[model samples]
Target: MPGTIAFVGDSLTAAGRWDEWLPEFTVSNHAAGGATTADVLAEVDVVLANRPDAYVLLIGTNDLAWRKSVEHVVRNVESILATVHKHEPSTRMLVQSVLPREPEFAASIRDINRHLWQYSSTVRAQFLDLWPVLADENGALSPVHSEDGLHLTAAGYELWLDALRPAIERLFAVPTTTTPIDVLSDAISVSGLR
Candidate 1:
């Protein structure tokens, strides 16, 4: 049996709809519109409670959209990661880079993602970059992959599904096999599980 995979993020990850992309694994989504890093921390409990084997996290567009400080955003993300560690240590979390915003907001989004990727590199979990697949030569979100300047359209989601396919495939081979919900229960008993 394979472990359950869950996606926990803001609109981009949620909008891409991972379910439509990978049909092989059991998947659950905890994405919501207008969610910032703080919002993510607020709802993370729901995701941990489900305890999927893997988690894909994309957030912070709203935070940048609101002109929140970079330090504040990073702090919130650090908090979220810490929570994930304490509650579900066994669950491997993917820290997804924040997508480039439209013309006006692109720079800040890039800054936020830069920090996220850097943090992911140093952390125990993984940081998956959705930037290249979604960005055009100008470093703006490609029109083909976006519904608006932000959310992904169908083609955009297809591109996302493809970019993440390898990671999803790797989930099947994880030695510990169980339904995602059960895995969380088992994970809770271990130390360092957030």
Candidate 2:
């Protein structure tokens, strides 16, 4: 009962080796480094063309980094969801909160995440708050988790994979008894499942 799942976003999503992490499923990583929501929107047709069973969206930090207002980022994200829904109504969508950045941008990231959490309800998508797991006590990306404070370290990706595993299991109806290592044996050879 394996299903195809796609990850769409900026470097955070692009950088994950999802096929290795979620070996039970066919994963497509459509993320690109430095991609903003607008960039995603532009290429969404290609994404929907793949017709994945589920999509994990994690863009918008770049937009904020570019100094776009929260409202702008939220609107673009809402549109992204809407576009997905319009093109692929049955696709299970997971809208992840924009991960916290340097301390200077923490406030804006928090604000954007709040709006995204609220907006997910409108599109029937689940919003995943990655802040608690990825951010340090000061609400900045943990040095232990990231070297550049933007891209993830091995520990960071491990944390992300842990948070993501159950959500994917729930979406795909995978049983808890199916261990990740076991799933690895079931892995399919997809060339671009980054």
Per-prediction TM-score to the true structure, in the order listed: 0.81, 0.86
Positional deviation of 44 in candidate 1, in angstroms? 1.6
CA lDDT of every candidate: 0.74, 0.84
The reply for model 2, stretches above 4 Å from the true place, is 173-194
Among all candidates shown, the one with the greatest TM-score: 2
Residues 1-194 of candidate 1 have per-residue lDDT tens digits of: 45678887776766654565666668898888788888888988888888787877878878988889888888898778767766676677778777776777667667877887777644356777888878876667777877577887788777777777765555444443223455666788775665
In terms of lDDT, the poorest run of 10 residues in model 1 is 171-180
Question: Distance from true position, residue 29, model 1, in Å?
Answer: 1.0
Residue 86 lDDT, candidate 1, scale 0-100: 60
lDDT of 1: 0.74
Cand. 1 TM to true fold: 0.81
